[model samples]
Target: MTNAKTLGQAFDVLLQPDKFRDYGPNGLQVEGDREVKLLVSGVTASRALIEAAIEAQADAIFVHHGLFWRGQDGRIVGWMRERLRLLLTHGIHLFAYHLPLDAHPELGNNAQLGRLLGWQADGRFGDQDLGFLGVSTQPWSRPQALADHVSAVLSRPVTCVGDMGQQVRRVAWCTGGAQGYFEAAIAQGVDAFITGEISEPQAHLARETGVAFLACGHHATERYGAPAVAARVAQDLGLQHRFIDIDNPA
Candidate 1:
Protein backbone atom coordinates (compact mmCIF):
# COMPACT_ATOMS: atom_id res chain seq x y z
CA MET A 1 0.00 0.00 0.00
CA THR A 2 1.20 3.51 -0.84
CA ASN A 3 -0.01 7.12 -0.63
CA ALA A 4 -2.54 7.52 -3.46
CA LYS A 5 -2.98 11.29 -3.39
CA THR A 6 0.77 11.82 -3.70
CA LEU A 7 0.79 9.65 -6.81
CA GLY A 8 -2.08 11.52 -8.47
CA GLN A 9 -0.44 14.89 -7.90
CA ALA A 10 2.83 13.71 -9.44
CA PHE A 11 1.12 12.26 -12.52
CA ASP A 12 -0.92 15.42 -13.07
CA VAL A 13 2.20 17.59 -12.92
CA LEU A 14 4.13 15.29 -15.25
CA LEU A 15 1.33 14.66 -17.78
CA GLN A 16 -0.28 18.16 -17.70
CA PRO A 17 -3.61 17.21 -19.33
CA ASP A 18 -4.61 20.88 -19.68
CA LYS A 19 -1.78 21.41 -22.18
CA PHE A 20 -3.55 19.48 -24.93
CA ARG A 21 -7.11 19.95 -26.13
CA ASP A 22 -7.71 16.21 -26.16
CA TYR A 23 -10.42 14.17 -27.86
CA GLY A 24 -11.41 12.75 -24.47
CA PRO A 25 -10.76 13.62 -20.87
CA ASN A 26 -7.37 13.12 -19.25
CA GLY A 27 -5.90 12.84 -15.78
CA LEU A 28 -8.26 10.97 -13.50
CA GLN A 29 -11.27 10.74 -15.77
CA VAL A 30 -13.03 8.31 -13.40
CA GLU A 31 -13.06 9.02 -9.72
CA GLY A 32 -12.21 6.59 -6.96
CA ASP A 33 -10.65 7.33 -3.61
CA ARG A 34 -8.81 10.65 -3.47
CA GLU A 35 -5.52 8.92 -2.72
CA VAL A 36 -4.00 5.77 -4.25
CA LYS A 37 -1.20 3.29 -3.63
CA LEU A 38 -0.80 0.73 -6.39
CA LEU A 39 -1.62 1.75 -9.96
CA VAL A 40 -2.50 -0.44 -12.92
CA SER A 41 -1.65 1.00 -16.33
CA GLY A 42 -2.50 -0.29 -19.79
CA VAL A 43 -3.14 0.69 -23.41
CA THR A 44 -6.93 0.71 -23.15
CA ALA A 45 -9.41 0.61 -20.30
CA SER A 46 -11.42 -2.43 -21.30
CA ARG A 47 -13.17 -4.99 -19.10
CA ALA A 48 -10.15 -7.26 -18.96
CA LEU A 49 -7.91 -4.42 -17.87
CA ILE A 50 -10.33 -3.44 -15.17
CA GLU A 51 -10.54 -7.02 -13.99
CA ALA A 52 -6.79 -7.13 -13.79
CA ALA A 53 -6.86 -3.94 -11.77
CA ILE A 54 -9.28 -5.49 -9.34
CA GLU A 55 -7.11 -8.55 -8.97
CA ALA A 56 -4.09 -6.40 -8.33
CA GLN A 57 -6.09 -4.38 -5.84
CA ALA A 58 -4.87 -1.27 -7.56
CA ASP A 59 -5.85 2.16 -6.34
CA ALA A 60 -6.04 3.51 -9.86
CA ILE A 61 -5.69 2.52 -13.52
CA PHE A 62 -3.96 4.76 -16.05
CA VAL A 63 -4.73 4.10 -19.66
CA HIS A 64 -4.28 5.61 -23.14
CA HIS A 65 -7.93 5.12 -24.13
CA GLY A 66 -10.84 5.29 -21.69
CA LEU A 67 -14.59 4.86 -22.06
CA PHE A 68 -17.13 7.65 -22.79
CA TRP A 69 -16.13 8.30 -26.40
CA ARG A 70 -17.19 11.25 -28.53
CA GLY A 71 -20.43 9.69 -29.83
CA GLN A 72 -21.03 7.21 -27.09
CA ASP A 73 -24.64 7.76 -26.21
CA GLY A 74 -25.02 8.95 -22.65
CA ARG A 75 -26.81 5.61 -22.12
CA ILE A 76 -25.08 3.24 -19.76
CA VAL A 77 -26.19 -0.09 -21.22
CA GLY A 78 -24.79 -3.14 -23.04
CA TRP A 79 -20.96 -3.24 -23.36
CA MET A 80 -20.52 0.15 -21.76
CA ARG A 81 -22.63 -0.93 -18.83
CA GLU A 82 -20.51 -3.97 -18.07
CA ARG A 83 -17.26 -2.04 -18.21
CA LEU A 84 -18.47 0.83 -16.10
CA ARG A 85 -19.97 -1.54 -13.60
CA LEU A 86 -16.61 -3.25 -13.25
CA LEU A 87 -14.73 0.00 -12.69
CA LEU A 88 -17.20 1.52 -10.25
CA THR A 89 -17.80 -1.65 -8.33
CA HIS A 90 -14.09 -2.25 -8.03
CA GLY A 91 -13.60 1.25 -6.68
CA ILE A 92 -10.75 1.82 -9.12
CA HIS A 93 -10.07 5.29 -10.48
CA LEU A 94 -9.46 5.52 -14.20
CA PHE A 95 -7.31 8.25 -15.75
CA ALA A 96 -7.10 8.46 -19.50
CA TYR A 97 -4.79 10.78 -21.43
CA HIS A 98 -5.74 10.63 -25.09
CA LEU A 99 -4.16 13.28 -27.34
CA PRO A 100 -2.44 14.76 -24.33
CA LEU A 101 -0.41 11.58 -23.89
CA ASP A 102 0.48 11.74 -27.57
CA ALA A 103 1.38 15.43 -27.32
CA HIS A 104 3.73 15.28 -24.35
CA PRO A 105 7.22 16.39 -25.41
CA GLU A 106 9.49 14.50 -23.04
CA LEU A 107 7.22 11.66 -21.99
CA GLY A 108 4.93 11.22 -25.01
CA ASN A 109 4.97 8.03 -27.08
CA ASN A 110 6.42 9.85 -30.11
CA ALA A 111 9.14 11.51 -28.07
CA GLN A 112 10.20 8.22 -26.47
CA LEU A 113 10.19 6.44 -29.85
CA GLY A 114 12.17 9.25 -31.49
CA ARG A 115 14.86 8.90 -28.84
CA LEU A 116 14.75 5.13 -29.20
CA LEU A 117 15.23 5.40 -32.96
CA GLY A 118 17.66 8.30 -32.64
CA TRP A 119 15.47 10.55 -34.76
CA GLN A 120 15.87 14.32 -34.41
CA ALA A 121 12.36 15.27 -33.27
CA ASP A 122 10.57 18.05 -35.08
CA GLY A 123 7.82 18.96 -32.66
CA ARG A 124 4.16 18.47 -33.73
CA PHE A 125 2.39 20.00 -36.72
CA GLY A 126 -1.14 21.50 -37.09
CA ASP A 127 -2.57 23.06 -33.92
CA GLN A 128 1.04 22.83 -32.88
CA ASP A 129 0.73 19.04 -32.45
CA LEU A 130 3.50 17.12 -30.68
CA GLY A 131 4.05 13.75 -32.33
CA PHE A 132 7.68 13.61 -33.49
CA LEU A 133 8.40 13.70 -37.22
CA GLY A 134 11.99 14.38 -38.15
CA VAL A 135 15.00 13.61 -40.35
CA SER A 136 17.29 10.71 -39.69
CA THR A 137 20.93 11.71 -39.63
CA GLN A 138 21.84 8.27 -40.95
CA PRO A 139 19.67 5.86 -42.88
CA TRP A 140 18.86 2.67 -41.00
CA SER A 141 20.52 -0.61 -41.97
CA ARG A 142 17.41 -1.17 -44.08
CA PRO A 143 13.65 -0.77 -43.74
CA GLN A 144 13.39 -4.37 -42.57
CA ALA A 145 16.18 -3.78 -40.11
CA LEU A 146 14.41 -0.79 -38.65
CA ALA A 147 11.07 -2.57 -38.60
CA ASP A 148 12.74 -5.47 -36.88
CA HIS A 149 14.25 -3.09 -34.38
CA VAL A 150 10.86 -1.51 -33.78
CA SER A 151 9.35 -4.97 -33.26
CA ALA A 152 12.07 -5.78 -30.75
CA VAL A 153 11.62 -2.51 -28.91
CA LEU A 154 7.83 -2.50 -28.91
CA SER A 155 7.55 -6.18 -27.95
CA ARG A 156 5.24 -7.03 -30.85
CA PRO A 157 5.52 -7.67 -34.56
CA VAL A 158 4.67 -4.70 -36.80
CA THR A 159 2.79 -4.98 -40.07
CA CYS A 160 4.92 -3.64 -42.92
CA VAL A 161 2.70 -1.85 -45.48
CA GLY A 162 5.20 -1.11 -48.23
CA ASP A 163 7.78 -3.13 -50.02
CA MET A 164 10.30 -4.84 -47.76
CA GLY A 165 12.90 -3.89 -50.37
CA GLN A 166 12.06 -0.21 -49.89
CA GLN A 167 14.37 2.13 -47.97
CA VAL A 168 13.22 4.65 -45.36
CA ARG A 169 13.95 8.36 -45.30
CA ARG A 170 12.19 11.17 -43.44
CA VAL A 171 9.44 9.40 -41.49
CA ALA A 172 6.43 10.78 -39.64
CA TRP A 173 4.73 8.82 -36.88
CA CYS A 174 2.10 8.97 -34.12
CA THR A 175 1.71 6.14 -31.68
CA GLY A 176 -1.33 4.02 -30.66
CA GLY A 177 -3.60 3.04 -33.51
CA ALA A 178 -3.34 6.23 -35.53
CA GLN A 179 -3.29 4.70 -39.01
CA GLY A 180 -6.17 7.01 -39.85
CA TYR A 181 -3.64 9.85 -40.01
CA PHE A 182 -1.61 8.32 -42.84
CA GLU A 183 -2.98 10.84 -45.30
CA ALA A 184 -1.84 13.70 -43.11
CA ALA A 185 1.69 12.29 -43.01
CA ILE A 186 1.64 11.83 -46.76
CA ALA A 187 0.60 15.45 -47.20
CA GLN A 188 3.76 16.32 -45.31
CA GLY A 189 5.69 14.37 -48.00
CA VAL A 190 7.10 11.82 -45.65
CA ASP A 191 9.08 8.89 -46.97
CA ALA A 192 7.28 6.72 -44.45
CA PHE A 193 4.44 6.98 -41.97
CA ILE A 194 4.47 4.91 -38.78
CA THR A 195 1.60 4.33 -36.40
CA GLY A 196 -0.32 1.67 -34.52
CA GLU A 197 -3.11 -0.36 -36.20
CA ILE A 198 -4.04 -0.55 -39.89
CA SER A 199 -7.12 -0.80 -42.06
CA GLU A 200 -7.81 -1.89 -45.65
CA PRO A 201 -8.02 1.76 -46.66
CA GLN A 202 -4.53 2.28 -45.31
CA ALA A 203 -3.08 0.05 -48.01
CA HIS A 204 -4.83 1.98 -50.79
CA LEU A 205 -3.74 5.25 -49.23
CA ALA A 206 -0.13 4.17 -48.81
CA ARG A 207 0.29 3.22 -52.44
CA GLU A 208 -1.64 6.22 -53.68
CA THR A 209 0.21 8.65 -51.45
CA GLY A 210 3.62 7.06 -52.18
CA VAL A 211 4.42 6.88 -48.49
CA ALA A 212 5.43 3.72 -46.66
CA PHE A 213 3.15 2.79 -43.77
CA LEU A 214 3.76 0.58 -40.77
CA ALA A 215 1.17 -0.61 -38.20
CA CYS A 216 3.21 -1.22 -35.11
CA GLY A 217 0.28 -2.42 -32.96
CA HIS A 218 -2.01 -0.11 -30.97
CA HIS A 219 -1.07 -1.56 -27.60
CA ALA A 220 2.64 -1.76 -28.38
CA THR A 221 3.06 1.79 -29.65
CA GLU A 222 1.32 3.49 -26.74
CA ARG A 223 2.89 1.87 -23.67
CA TYR A 224 5.39 4.66 -23.09
CA GLY A 225 3.08 7.14 -21.39
CA ALA A 226 1.86 4.90 -18.57
CA PRO A 227 5.37 3.76 -17.71
CA ALA A 228 6.76 7.25 -17.82
CA VAL A 229 3.81 8.40 -15.75
CA ALA A 230 4.49 5.57 -13.34
CA ALA A 231 8.15 6.49 -13.09
CA ARG A 232 7.34 10.10 -12.34
CA VAL A 233 4.93 8.98 -9.66
CA ALA A 234 7.61 6.81 -8.16
CA GLN A 235 10.24 9.54 -8.20
CA ASP A 236 8.01 12.21 -6.74
CA LEU A 237 6.62 9.97 -4.03
CA GLY A 238 9.64 7.69 -3.55
CA LEU A 239 7.59 4.50 -3.79
CA GLN A 240 8.51 0.98 -4.81
CA HIS A 241 7.44 0.42 -8.40
CA ARG A 242 7.38 -1.81 -11.46
CA PHE A 243 5.73 -1.12 -14.83
CA ILE A 244 3.61 -4.13 -15.71
CA ASP A 245 3.46 -4.69 -19.47
CA ILE A 246 0.31 -6.60 -20.47
CA ASP A 247 1.34 -7.98 -23.86
CA ASN A 248 -1.31 -7.16 -26.43
CA PRO A 249 -0.98 -8.22 -30.10
CA ALA A 250 -3.66 -5.91 -31.48
Candidate 2:
Protein backbone atom coordinates (compact mmCIF):
# COMPACT_ATOMS: atom_id res chain seq x y z
CA MET A 1 0.00 0.00 0.00
CA THR A 2 1.24 3.47 -0.92
CA ASN A 3 0.94 6.22 1.63
CA ALA A 4 -1.28 9.09 0.50
CA LYS A 5 0.97 11.72 2.08
CA THR A 6 4.02 10.30 0.34
CA LEU A 7 2.27 10.29 -3.03
CA GLY A 8 0.84 13.76 -2.55
CA GLN A 9 4.22 15.15 -1.52
CA ALA A 10 5.91 13.63 -4.53
CA PHE A 11 3.21 14.92 -6.85
CA ASP A 12 3.57 18.45 -5.43
CA VAL A 13 7.29 18.32 -6.13
CA LEU A 14 6.56 17.07 -9.63
CA LEU A 15 4.10 19.85 -10.49
CA GLN A 16 5.54 22.69 -8.37
CA PRO A 17 2.17 24.15 -7.44
CA ASP A 18 3.88 26.96 -5.53
CA LYS A 19 5.14 28.30 -8.87
CA PHE A 20 1.70 29.00 -10.28
CA ARG A 21 -1.26 31.00 -8.93
CA ASP A 22 -4.25 28.69 -9.33
CA TYR A 23 -7.99 29.27 -9.00
CA GLY A 24 -8.50 26.46 -6.48
CA PRO A 25 -6.46 24.38 -4.04
CA ASN A 26 -3.87 22.19 -5.69
CA GLY A 27 -3.57 18.89 -3.79
CA LEU A 28 -5.34 16.66 -1.29
CA GLN A 29 -8.81 18.20 -1.39
CA VAL A 30 -10.55 15.46 0.63
CA GLU A 31 -8.30 13.19 2.64
CA GLY A 32 -9.25 9.51 2.69
CA ASP A 33 -7.09 6.46 3.28
CA ARG A 34 -3.53 7.09 4.40
CA GLU A 35 -2.48 4.02 2.45
CA VAL A 36 -3.61 4.37 -1.16
CA LYS A 37 -3.50 0.99 -2.88
CA LEU A 38 -5.84 1.51 -5.80
CA LEU A 39 -5.68 5.03 -7.25
CA VAL A 40 -8.00 6.25 -10.00
CA SER A 41 -7.48 9.33 -12.18
CA GLY A 42 -9.95 11.36 -14.22
CA VAL A 43 -10.56 14.80 -15.73
CA THR A 44 -12.97 15.99 -13.08
CA ALA A 45 -13.99 15.02 -9.53
CA SER A 46 -17.68 14.84 -10.40
CA ARG A 47 -20.21 12.48 -8.80
CA ALA A 48 -20.01 10.22 -11.86
CA LEU A 49 -16.25 9.93 -11.54
CA ILE A 50 -16.48 9.33 -7.78
CA GLU A 51 -19.03 6.56 -8.39
CA ALA A 52 -16.76 5.03 -10.99
CA ALA A 53 -13.86 5.20 -8.56
CA ILE A 54 -15.98 3.54 -5.92
CA GLU A 55 -16.90 0.76 -8.33
CA ALA A 56 -13.24 0.37 -9.27
CA GLN A 57 -12.35 0.09 -5.55
CA ALA A 58 -10.10 3.11 -5.72
CA ASP A 59 -8.51 4.33 -2.52
CA ALA A 60 -7.82 7.75 -4.00
CA ILE A 61 -9.12 9.85 -6.89
CA PHE A 62 -6.79 12.25 -8.65
CA VAL A 63 -8.23 14.81 -11.02
CA HIS A 64 -7.62 18.08 -12.85
CA HIS A 65 -10.79 19.83 -11.68
CA GLY A 66 -11.52 19.27 -7.96
CA LEU A 67 -14.03 20.58 -5.48
CA PHE A 68 -14.34 24.27 -4.49
CA TRP A 69 -13.56 26.96 -7.04
CA ARG A 70 -12.62 30.55 -6.24
CA GLY A 71 -16.15 31.96 -6.40
CA GLN A 72 -18.18 28.81 -5.93
CA ASP A 73 -20.39 28.34 -2.91
CA GLY A 74 -18.33 27.07 0.01
CA ARG A 75 -21.28 25.38 1.72
CA ILE A 76 -21.56 21.66 1.17
CA VAL A 77 -25.06 21.33 -0.36
CA GLY A 78 -26.80 20.15 -3.52
CA TRP A 79 -24.52 18.52 -6.11
CA MET A 80 -21.37 19.49 -4.24
CA ARG A 81 -22.75 17.87 -1.10
CA GLU A 82 -23.65 14.74 -2.99
CA ARG A 83 -20.17 14.45 -4.53
CA LEU A 84 -18.45 14.96 -1.20
CA ARG A 85 -20.83 12.59 0.57
CA LEU A 86 -19.95 9.79 -1.83
CA LEU A 87 -16.21 10.32 -1.43
CA LEU A 88 -16.37 10.64 2.35
CA THR A 89 -18.66 7.64 2.62
CA HIS A 90 -16.25 5.45 0.68
CA GLY A 91 -12.96 6.68 2.25
CA ILE A 92 -11.75 7.88 -1.14
CA HIS A 93 -9.05 10.52 -1.14
CA LEU A 94 -9.52 13.38 -3.62
CA PHE A 95 -6.45 15.11 -5.06
CA ALA A 96 -6.61 17.81 -7.69
CA TYR A 97 -4.13 19.78 -9.74
CA HIS A 98 -5.22 22.80 -11.75
CA LEU A 99 -2.89 25.42 -13.33
CA PRO A 100 0.19 23.40 -12.40
CA LEU A 101 -1.11 20.50 -14.49
CA ASP A 102 -1.63 22.86 -17.43
CA ALA A 103 1.86 24.36 -17.13
CA HIS A 104 3.82 21.09 -16.75
CA PRO A 105 6.23 20.68 -19.68
CA GLU A 106 5.82 16.96 -20.31
CA LEU A 107 2.48 15.97 -18.76
CA GLY A 108 0.69 19.27 -19.29
CA ASN A 109 -2.36 19.65 -21.52
CA ASN A 110 -0.59 22.06 -23.93
CA ALA A 111 2.50 19.85 -24.22
CA GLN A 112 0.42 16.68 -24.71
CA LEU A 113 -1.74 18.46 -27.28
CA GLY A 114 1.41 19.59 -29.07
CA ARG A 115 2.80 16.05 -29.02
CA LEU A 116 -0.49 14.65 -30.38
CA LEU A 117 -0.47 17.20 -33.21
CA GLY A 118 3.31 16.78 -33.78
CA TRP A 119 3.84 20.50 -33.24
CA GLN A 120 7.15 21.83 -31.92
CA ALA A 121 6.86 23.99 -28.82
CA ASP A 122 8.93 27.11 -29.37
CA GLY A 123 8.16 28.81 -26.08
CA ARG A 124 5.40 29.82 -23.68
CA PHE A 125 3.29 33.00 -23.73
CA GLY A 126 0.13 34.48 -22.18
CA ASP A 127 -0.98 34.26 -18.50
CA GLN A 128 1.58 32.59 -16.24
CA ASP A 129 3.15 31.06 -19.35
CA LEU A 130 0.17 28.73 -19.72
CA GLY A 131 -0.15 29.47 -23.44
CA PHE A 132 1.94 27.24 -25.71
CA LEU A 133 3.73 28.64 -28.75
CA GLY A 134 4.27 26.06 -31.45
CA VAL A 135 4.20 25.28 -35.14
CA SER A 136 2.83 22.36 -37.12
CA THR A 137 5.43 19.99 -38.63
CA GLN A 138 4.11 20.94 -42.06
CA PRO A 139 2.44 24.27 -42.54
CA TRP A 140 -1.29 23.80 -43.08
CA SER A 141 -1.86 26.01 -46.12
CA ARG A 142 -5.61 26.25 -45.58
CA PRO A 143 -7.46 27.00 -42.34
CA GLN A 144 -9.92 24.19 -43.13
CA ALA A 145 -7.04 21.73 -43.37
CA LEU A 146 -5.82 22.71 -39.90
CA ALA A 147 -9.35 22.43 -38.54
CA ASP A 148 -9.70 18.99 -40.08
CA HIS A 149 -6.36 17.99 -38.55
CA VAL A 150 -7.48 19.18 -35.09
CA SER A 151 -10.81 17.35 -35.38
CA ALA A 152 -8.95 14.20 -36.36
CA VAL A 153 -6.44 14.51 -33.51
CA LEU A 154 -8.98 15.26 -30.75
CA SER A 155 -11.71 13.10 -32.33
CA ARG A 156 -14.33 15.73 -31.69
CA PRO A 157 -16.12 18.40 -33.70
CA VAL A 158 -14.34 21.75 -33.57
CA THR A 159 -15.72 25.26 -33.99
CA CYS A 160 -13.41 27.13 -36.34
CA VAL A 161 -13.66 30.85 -37.09
CA GLY A 162 -11.66 32.91 -39.61
CA ASP A 163 -10.82 32.38 -43.25
CA MET A 164 -10.50 28.65 -44.01
CA GLY A 165 -8.20 29.36 -46.97
CA GLN A 166 -5.66 31.31 -44.86
CA GLN A 167 -2.25 29.69 -44.50
CA VAL A 168 -1.36 28.76 -40.91
CA ARG A 169 1.87 27.38 -39.48
CA ARG A 170 2.62 29.35 -36.33
CA VAL A 171 0.12 28.43 -33.64
CA ALA A 172 -0.50 29.16 -29.97
CA TRP A 173 -2.71 27.13 -27.64
CA CYS A 174 -4.10 27.18 -24.11
CA THR A 175 -6.40 24.33 -23.22
CA GLY A 176 -9.88 24.53 -21.62
CA GLY A 177 -11.97 27.68 -21.20
CA ALA A 178 -9.24 29.99 -22.43
CA GLN A 179 -11.23 32.06 -24.91
CA GLY A 180 -10.20 35.18 -22.96
CA TYR A 181 -6.64 34.55 -24.07
CA PHE A 182 -7.46 35.34 -27.71
CA GLU A 183 -6.15 38.89 -27.36
CA ALA A 184 -2.96 37.54 -25.89
CA ALA A 185 -2.74 35.06 -28.77
CA ILE A 186 -3.34 37.88 -31.25
CA ALA A 187 -0.47 39.82 -29.69
CA GLN A 188 1.77 36.80 -30.26
CA GLY A 189 0.98 37.13 -34.00
CA VAL A 190 0.29 33.41 -34.31
CA ASP A 191 -1.38 32.20 -37.48
CA ALA A 192 -3.95 30.36 -35.35
CA PHE A 193 -5.16 30.20 -31.77
CA ILE A 194 -6.62 27.00 -30.30
CA THR A 195 -8.49 26.67 -27.04
CA GLY A 196 -11.18 24.53 -25.40
CA GLU A 197 -14.20 26.83 -25.18
CA ILE A 198 -15.19 30.00 -27.08
CA SER A 199 -17.45 32.91 -26.26
CA GLU A 200 -19.65 34.83 -28.70
CA PRO A 201 -17.36 37.86 -28.70
CA GLN A 202 -14.43 35.64 -29.69
CA ALA A 203 -16.27 34.63 -32.86
CA HIS A 204 -16.39 38.32 -33.87
CA LEU A 205 -12.84 38.80 -32.68
CA ALA A 206 -11.67 35.88 -34.79
CA ARG A 207 -13.41 37.41 -37.81
CA GLU A 208 -11.81 40.79 -37.14
CA THR A 209 -8.33 39.54 -36.16
CA GLY A 210 -7.70 37.27 -39.16
CA VAL A 211 -6.17 34.67 -36.83
CA ALA A 212 -8.00 31.36 -36.86
CA PHE A 213 -9.72 30.34 -33.61
CA LEU A 214 -10.53 26.69 -32.93
CA ALA A 215 -12.68 25.72 -29.95
CA CYS A 216 -11.99 22.12 -29.28
CA GLY A 217 -14.13 20.63 -26.48
CA HIS A 218 -13.03 21.78 -23.02
CA HIS A 219 -13.03 18.20 -21.68
CA ALA A 220 -11.32 16.79 -24.77
CA THR A 221 -8.37 19.16 -24.53
CA GLU A 222 -7.80 18.70 -20.77
CA ARG A 223 -8.26 14.90 -20.51
CA TYR A 224 -4.53 14.13 -20.67
CA GLY A 225 -2.94 15.87 -17.69
CA ALA A 226 -4.61 14.17 -14.74
CA PRO A 227 -3.99 10.62 -15.93
CA ALA A 228 -0.43 11.40 -16.93
CA VAL A 229 0.34 12.86 -13.53
CA ALA A 230 -1.53 10.08 -11.76
CA ALA A 231 0.36 7.41 -13.66
CA ARG A 232 3.62 8.97 -12.61
CA VAL A 233 2.37 9.07 -9.03
CA ALA A 234 1.44 5.40 -9.17
CA GLN A 235 4.83 4.45 -10.58
CA ASP A 236 6.65 6.47 -7.99
CA LEU A 237 4.47 5.24 -5.12
CA GLY A 238 4.20 1.64 -6.29
CA LEU A 239 0.42 1.81 -6.36
CA GLN A 240 -2.03 0.32 -8.81
CA HIS A 241 -3.49 3.07 -10.97
CA ARG A 242 -6.47 3.15 -13.31
CA PHE A 243 -7.76 6.04 -15.38
CA ILE A 244 -11.55 6.37 -15.39
CA ASP A 245 -12.85 8.57 -18.18
CA ILE A 246 -16.44 9.66 -17.67
CA ASP A 247 -17.97 10.99 -20.88
CA ASN A 248 -17.97 14.78 -21.08
CA PRO A 249 -19.30 16.53 -24.20
CA ALA A 250 -18.07 19.93 -23.05
**In lDDT terms, which candidate is top?**
2
Residue by residue across 1-250, what tens digits does model 2's lDDT show?
Answer: 7777887898899999999888989989998855789889999999999999999999999999999789887898899899989988988899999999999999988888888888899989988999999888989997778888889988999999987767898999999999999999999989899999999999898888889999999999998888888898799778899999988999
Q: Best-fitting candidate, measured by TM-score?
A: 2
- Write the residue-wise lDDT of candidate 1 on 1-250 in tens digits: 4544555566777777777766766666677753566767777888887887788777788777888667568888998899888888877778777777777788777787777767887646544475467877667645667677778877778777665556777888888767777777877767777788899999887766557788888877787876776667666665544455667777
Poorest lDDT segment (10 consecutive residues) of candidate 1: 123-132
The lDDT values for all models are: 0.73, 0.90
Task: Report model 2's TM-score to 2 decimal places.
Answer: 0.97
For model 2, what is the error of residue 191's alpha carbon versus the real structure, in angstroms, after optimal superposition?
A: 0.5
Q: Which residues of candidate 2, in runs, are more than 4 Å off?
A: none
Q: After TM-score superposition, what is the CA distance of residue 110 in candidate 2 from its true location, in Å?
A: 1.1
